[model samples]
Target: MEFWNDIAIEKSWKVLIGLRKEIDFILIGGWACYLLTHTIKSKDIDIIVDFEGLEKLRKKHPLKKTPFLKKYEALIEGISIEIYVPFYSVFAIPPEEIQKFSIQVEGFRIPEPEILLILKQQAELARKDSVKGQKDRVDIINLLMNSELI
Candidate 1:
């Protein structure tokens, strides 16, 4: 997965292009944070989509239902992509909010600092594992340091 850290952004753009216009979603989690900080390493991609977006994605790819994670997941080009549908997760950030914080980078719409901070905070609290919680904390800090939010 070390190679993932080097090409994460490029790979993200490829995945977005593959999804095309049919999906309306925002990049979230570690990958999103990495885009901003450009210092973190993430092996997987995390996204949040509305129900309509989920349905649209279903047409193009095989998504395995992961009710446990409040997401539908797929492995694309060796990267695990987790797609969350706002309702089931404790982190229910609306698309409107996401749009407001979104930035277009290399043709991919990625979540900005404020949104990443919000999600990271939520993840820090929701994760029971100390390691995950700590990683979330570090992500929050990175976003804070690198973003224009300060």
Candidate 2:
């Protein structure tokens, strides 16, 4: 599958926007950083949802319960939609509390850049030495330099 290139990233972003029509979610990960800083487009889409919302998503997609990774997942148009739930998901800040830390922009709810930084930091630690981790470092830098949170 094409990944990280502009075409793939744009397609991923479009998938994210399309999913908003059916589910309520708190945007997170690289896409959230893109909303705040516009640094780099995310190669994949990540979002936080309540249990009810997760069920709705499952009705439409083949959602996988990946307890080991602490999130649910599905694929749409070759882009992964990684779904995080409050109790089951691991995030820098609790997923349920993410709403308190978020603001609406472009019809999507996303955590503030400060929280995004923390989340990116956690991701970097989790995937250190991988290409995704390298992108996380760049995203962290972009947020620190461009976001008002810094």
* Model 1 pairs in collision: none
Candidate 2 lDDT for residue 16: 88
Candidate number achieving the greatest lDDT relative to the actual structure: 2
lDDT of 2 at 139: 87
TM-score of each: 0.73, 0.94
Per-residue lDDT over 49-113 for candidate 1, one digit per residue giving the tens place of the 0 to 100 score? 88888887788778899777666898877667888776564464665567677887555578777
lDDT per model, in order? 0.72, 0.86
Model 2, C-alpha of 91: deviation from truth (Å): 1.9
The number of residue pairs in model 1 that clash at the backbone is: 0
Q: Candidate 2: misplaced stretches above 4 Å?
A: 1-3
Tell me the deviation in Å of residue 123 in model 1.
1.3
Per-residue lDDT, model 2, residue 114, is 77
